[model samples]
Target: MIGEQGDGESVGTSAGNKRCRNKQQAGKDVAVQGTNDSSIVSKCSMASLGYFNDGFLKGFVNKTTRRAPLINRGYYVRAKAVDYSLHCFLQKTASYSQRQILSLGAGFDSLYFRLKASGELENVIVYEVDFPDVVQRKATLIKNKQEFMELIGCMNEIKPAQMDNLYLCGLDYKLLGIDMTEIVDLDNLLMETGLNPACPTLLLSEVVLTYMRDASSSAVIHWAANRFSSAIFVVYEQIRPDDPFGQVMQQHFTHLNSTLHALTQFPGKEAQRKRFLSEGWEECHCIDMNEFYTGFIPEQEKRRIEMLEPFDEYEEWHLKCSHYLILSASKGDLKTCLSFHPPPDFHAIKLDTFDPLWICVSPCEIESENPLLRRFAHCSSLIAPNIVLISGGFGSRAGHHGRLRGATLMTKSGPVWKCSFVGNEGSIHLLTERMFHSMTSFCDSCCVIFGGRTSPLKPVTSVLLLKCEVGDGTISSISLSVKEIECIGTAPSPRWRHTATEVIYKGQRYLFIYGGRSPKEMVLNDWHFLNLEDYSWADIPVIGPTPESRHSHSACSWKGGVLIAGGLGATQIPLASVFHLRPTQSGFFWNRIEVTGSFIPRYSHTAHILDDKLFLLGGVTIYSDSIPEVTLIDLKTGQSLDYHINTNLVKWPVMLHNHSSVLLVKERQVLVVGGGGNCFSFGTHLNHQPVLLQLPEIK
Candidate 1:
C-alpha cells in the first residue's frame, strides 16, 4: 500500500540502515560483560538484544534484507499490548484520588512525556524505569532532540488540589553488575526515583516483555499487582503464528548478524503471547498488526509508508508482510477492560452537577492558599454539566520530576478534583478514566465503571455494585456488593483499556462487554451480559459484522441503544468512525454509523451521554498532543455534532486521562480527576502536575 502512495511505485526494498547496524555493534560492547561468573549468567539471558549481535555480518545481512519499518510486527504487537494495558489501567483507576505511573523498559518511549505537554496531568507522579544504558541513551536523545515533537511533553503549568512530580529512575537492570532478573524491584526503583505507590499506579512494558522468559515477565506483573491501590501492567509483543515474511526477514537478519534478542525464545510472535498469558498474567485481547494496517492505512498515507521500506537492496530479498495487534489486561477492575458510549453536550449545563477537570499543581505552588486548586492553571474534558467524564492525562513538574494522578466522583456540592494526594487515599472510588467513551448515569446516585483500559483479564462473571449512598451531601467510598462473583456460563476476560457501556433495558442494568484484550493480551469482540441483580455474567451472542477488537474507542448509551465513537482498535493504527448497537434480551444488535466530520481516532479521550446526546472532548489528534475538539452524538435522530473550540481560549486543554472528577453540588457538571500518559500517547511526556478546569459552557 505504501509503495503506491505518491509515485504509485511498487513496494520496493531498500538498503538496510548501516547506522542501525553499526549502533547494534556499538551495543555489543556491554554484551555479556564478565561472563566468567555463572551467577551473572543467571542474572539475565534477556541480554539477547546484545546476544543477537552474535554475528555482525549476519546482523547486517538481516538489516540489508529488510526495509526500515521491516514488519517489526512483533514490536508493534508488544507496543500495542503495553499501550492498551496501560490505557485500561488508567481508565479503571479514574476514580482514584491519586495515580502513579511506572514504565519499565522505557527505551526512548514517550507516552508519559506527551501527556504532560498537553497540561492534562494532575497530582500524578510518573517513574520511567529502564536499564542505565537505555535510560542514559533516552535522556541524551531527548535532550539532543529537545526541539522535536517527541520531546515536547505537557508543560507543568496547571496546579490541581494537590502536589506531585514526574519522577525518573535511571537504574541498570544488571544490578550488582548482574542480578539477571533484568527487572528491578519496583519498590526500590520507586524509592530511588522518589515516588510513592500508596496511590493507584500503572506499569508498562513494550518489546521488553517478549525478550524475557514468560515466568520472569509474570513475576514483575504479580509484584506490581500487590504494590498500589490499583495497579496495571501493560505488555507489548508480537503474536503472529506463521509469519512467512518474518522467516525471510529473520533469515536475512541471521545473515546480517543483528541482535535477534526479543526473538530469542519464541519461534514466532503469538507463541510469545500465548506463553506469557499461560505463565500467570491473564490473556485479555489480541489484534493482528496486518489486520490493523489494512483497515486503517486506506491504501494511502505515504510518509508513514516510507518509514517501513527496507534500506538494503529491496529487490534481492523477498519481503514478508506481517500484521500487529495490541492486547491489554489488568489485575482487577484496575484496567485492561472494554466499554461503549457517546459524550454529552455541554448545552445541558445545570447547577449542582459535577464537572471534572485537569491541571498540574506547580511544585513551587503546591502549598498555595487554595491547595484545592492553588496553582491550578488549566484543565481539559468537555465544558458541560450534563453527563460528565474525562480521560486520563499526563503532566510534568515545574522542573521535571514527579507524575500526576486522575480521579472522578459525584456529590451534592458539585464536581471536585484532588490530584495526587498519597496523603488521602479517598479518591479510589471514582474513575476519571475516559477521554473518549461516553458514560451514562442510570440514576442520580449511580456511576458505573465500564468499557475502558484495564482492558482485559478473566472476567469475574459478575457485576460489581458499589451501592453508592450519597450521604452528608458527598459520595462516600463505596463498598463492594459482593466479595466475589464467579461465572458458570460465558464471561469476558479481565480487560484493561477497552470500552464497556450500560444498556438500560426494562429498568435493569445490563453491562455489555466487548473489544478488549485477553489474559494473553489479544483484542476480542465477544459480548457478555452482566445482570446487576443476578450478579452474574452470561454470554449473549451479538449479531452483525462486529467491529474489530478495539480499545480506546468511545461508547455511550442514549435513545434506546449504544453509540461508539472513534478510538484505537488494538490495531497499529487508530480508527475514526461511529458504531451503534441496541441491546435486547438475547445479546447485542450491531449497526455501523458514520458521523459527518471525522473525529480523531484516539485513546484516553473522554465521552459522556445524556438525554439522547453524547459529548466528546480532547484526546490524541493527528498531532500526538491532544486537541480541544468537542463533539456530540444524538442517538434519537441518528446524527452527531462536532464542535471545534479554540483550546487556546481554555488556557490549557489536557487529555486528562485517569484524572479524578466529582459532580458539582446541585449542578449538571461531573468533576473529572487526574492521570498520566503512558508510552507518550498525549502531547506531554510526564504527568506530575495538578490543576482543575471549570469545563466551559458546552453549547
Candidate 2:
C-alpha cells in the first residue's frame, strides 16, 4: 500500500511538469503568430502602392499602415519569390488532373482568395495550416468580409464556432487549425481531410519553420517527403546569423519571444539546401533574394517598382536581401522541379577563399568628455596631422535623434583622442545641419564643404569654406571659422552622396566633384571642376567618355587626377568598374582602368591612394557573408585583392556602411568613425565609438 502511494505521487509530479512545459510552449506559439500580423500589414502596404496587384490583402489586415520604402521593396521581393515558386509548380504539372498547395503556418494569408480571383485555381487546391487560434481569427475575418465569402463560393459554409481543426471545407480550399508540432496527429488530420497522396503537392513555409524547434520542423519536412508521391518544398527564412545585420535580425525575433531555431544549425544557403537533402529529399536549390532581384525579375517590372517611392536606403535594402533566402527541395518524380534558374550571365566572386592580405582593427581610445559618436552618413576629414574634423550626420543630439546641428573636432594628444563640439549658435549651423555632404581639405587649415541635404527633400545647395587655426597644438587654443563661398559660373545641381577629390591640372589645384544624387534625381553622373584659386566653376573639358551614372562611390586623387571606383549604378546595382580622370595637355579625359581580381562589387565605401596602391575601405555588398573588407588595388599592375580585418579587437558590431573614415598617413592607420543605419524593421544601429584599423606593410 505504501509503494502504491509513492507511485501515485510520482505520477502527479510528472504530470505537473508536463503541464508547465506545455503552457510555456503555448505562449511562444502566440508570439510566433504575432509575426504574421506584422507581415500581412507590410504586404498590404506593398500591394496598395502598386508593387503588385493583390486585391485581397486588405481583408486580412485591420489597419494598413504605410511602411518605409525599404520595407515595401523587401515585401515586394518576397511576394514575387513565392509567386514564382507557385507558378512554376502549377506550370510543370499542368497536364496532371489534380495538384495541391499546402502552406504551413499560414496565418491570415490571402493566398487562396488571390489565386482564386485570378482564375489560376482551375484544378488546383490550396490547404492552409496554422495554430488553432490564428486559424479561427482568420476564419472570422474572412466570414466578416462578404467579398472573401463570395470568392470562396461558400457564403455560409465556414462555421467558426463548430470548427476545431478543420475551420473551412470547400470544393477547392481547406483550412486546418492545429499545432503542427504534433506530427502524428497532423498527418492523421491531413489524411482524413481527403488529402490525396498521389497528387502533385507543393508545401510553402515562409519564415514559418524557423520559429519552431529544430526537431519539430525537421519532422514536418520528413513527413511531407514521405507522404507525397511527387512534391516540392519551398521555404523562406533568414541566414548568416553571425554578421552584424544577422545579429540584429536574430535579436529582433528574440525580443519578441519568437526565436529562429534553424539559423543556429543551418545558417546559410548551402546548409539550408543540405538540410532537406539529408531529410529524405532527392534534390534542392537555394538562392538569396539579392540574386533573385538581379537575375530573375524582369527589367521592366524592376524599373516600375524602383520609381514607386523615393528610396535612398540601398544599403539596408541589399543587406536585408542578403540575410534571407528562398530554397526549394524536391522528391520522387519532381526531383527536377526548381523554383527558378540562375541567369546565364550570373557570376559571384568566390568570397570564402583565403586572401593573403590582413589588417588589425581596434577601437580608438577617446576621453569620457568627448561628444557621443553615435552617427552615420557623416563626414570626417583629416584637417591636420593630429586633428580630425567630423561634421554633419543623422544621429543623437541632446538625447534626441535627428540631423546634427554641430560639428566635432577630434584632436590627438599622445595616444589618446579628445573631441569637442564646434559652436552651433552661428554660421557653423549651416555647415553642421546637413548629412551626406562632401568635405575636401585643401590645406592643413582650410577645407571646402559643399552640397548636402537636411532631409530627402531639403538639400543644402550653398557652398561653405571652413578654416581652422591651431595655437601651440592645444585643444583649448584651437579655433574655427566658416564663410559662404560665392562661385561665379553655372554650378552643379544640389546633390549629396558625392565625392570631392583635389586634383592638380597644369600645377593648378582644383576640387573635382563627381557623381551624386539629388532630391529631384535619384542619380547624377555629371562632373564639375571648382578652381580653388578663384573659387569658380572651371570650364576646361576634353572628356572622351564618362563613367556610368552612380552615387555612393569612392574617389581619391591619383597621379595628379582623380581615380573613382565602385558605386551604385543607374540600375541600382553596385558597379565594379574603375575609371581614372587622366589629366591631358588639352584638358582632362576619363580613362577606364581594368582591375584584375575576384572583387565583389560594393558601394558607400571610403578610398585613399597611397604609393600607387588604392585602398577601398568598408562598403556594403550583397554577394558575400563577410563584412566590408579593405580592397587593395595596384594602380600600376591593375591587380586588386581584398584584405580581411581582424574584428576581434573591437567591442561592438562593426557596421561600416553610411560611415566616414580618415587615413592617418603618419600613423599608417585608418580611423573608421560613425557608421551604421536603420536596419530595416529591426531598429537604428550606430557605432558608439571610433574604430582604428592598422594597415599592413604593402609591397
Candidate 3:
C-alpha cells in the first residue's frame, strides 16, 4: 500500500497502485484535484504487456521480456503500430494549414516533433495538451534521457514546457470545459510558424481515449472537429473493457484497472468512431486491434509479430489490451475525408497476439490448465481442450524428447509431472518409459497416452497411463503408485500424430481419439474412443455433418464428442472450421459449426473449456506460421466471442498447447513446467509493459 504524504494524500499514486480506502484513510483523505494548473499532463508508465504473461499466456512473449515489461512484445508492437501508422498518415498531404492536429491527453508523445523535424509539417502546426507532471516528465526525459533523448528531443523544439506553436494545456478533461479556454494563446506560436486551420491534414491521438470519462472524450472530438475545417484526425488506443492487457494493471497500480478508472462509455472502438458521427466528424474508418495485423498486414509480416502482457489473471499484472486502432475523419463531405487516409498503408500484423501473458505455474493455475494429460511421439503430445495445449513438429528438449507432451497432472495444490514417469519407477513401463504421445485426464488421478513417432520416418501405436497422487507442497515432484500399465485395446488402427480427448458419459469415462498417421497412409479420419474402466477401444457409429478425413485438427470435449476445430491432411490444407460430437449416445452425433466472422481457417490453434466456455488460443492461421487468433465460444449460449490471447499463449495463459504448464505452490501463479505450452494465463514475451510508454508502473 502507498504511504500517505504529509499532506495526507498519496504522492505519485497511479491507476495500478492506489491504496484501498479504509475507514481511517477514507475519512482523512481529501481528494485533491490536480493543482498543476500549467498546461501539461502527468501519465505514469504502466507496464501492461507483462500482465498477459500470467499463469496462462506464457509461451507467447520471451520469459525475460514478460518479467521486464519495459522491453517486450508490447513495447515493440506499440512502437511499430504507432510509428508506421503515423508516418503513413502524415506523408499524405502536401499542405497543413486548417488541418489541426490535436492529441487528446497526449503523453510524452513525439509524433508532432518527428513530423516537424522531417519538415513534413512546414505548413502544419501541431497541438498537444496533457497534465503538468506528464509534460514536465517528458521535458526532463528529453533533457536527460539518452537512447530516448532523440525521440523526446523532437518535441523539445516547441517547449516552454507548455509548448509554443504546440500549446500544451494541462487540465483534466473528466470535468469537461470548466478550466479550458476557447483560445489557448497559441496564435503567436502559429503565426511565428505561419500555419493555421485552412490547410490539409490535422490531428493525432494515440492510446488516449481509455483514460477519459466518455463525455469528456467526446468533447475533445467535438472541440477539434469545430476548430479545424478539413482535418483528418488519427486516434489510437486499446478499447476492450475487460481486456487482460489493461484490467490486470490494477495489481501494479491502483485505480488504473478497467473496473476502477477507465472511461465507462463509448466502450468499443467502432462505437467510439460512431460517436464522432454525432459530433460532425464524418467519414470515419477504424481498425480493430486484431484486424490491424490480420486485414492490413501480409501473411509473412504477421508471423514475426508478438505483443506482451503479464502471466496471470490475479497476479500483480493482468491487463488485457486489443487494438492499435487508427481512426481518420474530416468535417466536409465523406468522400474527401475518406480519400485522405489510404487503405494500403493500414496493414495489420497478424502474427502477434493482442495482449501478452505467461503460462500458469501454480497448482490452482495448473488444475485449470488440464485435468487430462497425453504423451505422444518424441516429446510431441496432444491435450484435449485444444485451447491451451501446444503442439510441435519442432521436436523436444530434456528427457521428454518430442513436442506437445500432454503428460502432466494438476492437483488442487500443484502440478505433478506424470508423463515423464509412467507407471511407477519400479514398474516395467518405466524401464523403457515411453515419451511423445497423446494424453488427457480421466477421473481423479488417471491419464491416457497414445501414438507418437520416434523420428520423422518412424511410427508407433502405443498408449499408456500414469496414476496421480494428492501430495504435499507445490508439485515439484510426483511418485506414481501404479507400477506398469501399457494397456492396448482393439483400437481402430495403429497410428501416431493424432489428437485425443476424454469425456464422461453414463457415469463412465471414455477417451475419444481422432485423426492420426499410419505406416501406409499419411493421414486417417478415424474416430475411436477407449473405455478406461474396461480397457477397450470402440468405434461408435458417428452420424451428422462431417468434414473430409483428416488429422492435426484440435479435438476438444464439447457437448460430448470432442470439438475438432483445426487440423491438416485433407486437400493438404489446414482446417478453419470447428465441430463437436457425443461419445456414447447411440451414434456419435457430429455437428459441424459455422466458422464465421474473423475466424481464420487453419491448424495449430488451441481450444480449452473453462467455466464451460470454449476459448480458442493461438494456432497457425491460414498457410502461415503466425499463431491462431484466440476466441471464446460459450457452450451454454453458443455465442462466439473474440479476445486477445498471446498467440504463443496457446501454450498456457488461458490455455496451454504442446508445452507443460504446471501450477506452482501459489494459488495464483502457474508454472509452464515443460512440454509444449499447456497451462493457465501466465507467460511472457517478457514483462508486459503497457503500450502507452509513459504510464508509470504501479508500485
Which digits, one per residue and each the tens of the lDDT, describe model 2 over residues 208-299? Answer: 99987787888899999888989999998899898878888888999999999899999988898888999888889998898899888999
- lDDT of candidate model 1 versus the reference: 0.41
- Cα TM-score per model: 0.40, 0.94, 0.48
Candidate 3's TM-score reads 0.48
Pull out the clashing pairs in model 2.
Answer: none
Number of clashing pairs per prediction, in order = 267, 0, 200
Q: Can you write out model 1's per-residue Cα lDDT over 31-74, one digit (the tens) per residue?
A: 42211122112111211222111121121111223212222332
lDDT of each: 0.41, 0.86, 0.44
Which regions in candidate 3 have their CA more than 4 angstroms from the true location?
A: 1-71, 75-77, 95-101, 112-124, 144-195, 242-254, 257-263, 304-324, 333-438, 441-446, 449-464, 467-498, 501-553, 556-563, 566-699
RMSD of each: 24.9, 4.0, 14.4
Q: What is the lDDT of residue 291 in candidate 2?
A: 89
Residue 448 accuracy (lDDT) in model 2: 91
Can you tell me which runs of candidate 1 are displaced by over 4 Å? Answer: 1-463, 474-482, 486-488, 539-541, 584-588, 621-628, 634-653, 656-670, 679-699
Which lDDT tens digits does candidate 3 get at residues 1-699? 346443234666663444354443332211111212111111111123322112211211123222233224334444454555555545555443334455554554555544545556544445555544445545454445453344233332333332332332221011011112223443333333334555554566665544443544566678667766666776666454333333333222233222222334555555766777787786777655334433454554533332222211111111222323556666642225433232453332343346542222222223232322332122322222211222222223343423332233332322322222232244433323333346576665555656655443455555566555544523444444333344555656766557778766666777877886665665688777788787777656778876667665566676655777766644434566677786555657777666444454545444555556555654433222233445556666566544443323233223223333321122322233232321112222121100000111111
**How well does candidate 1 score on lDDT at residue 380?**
28
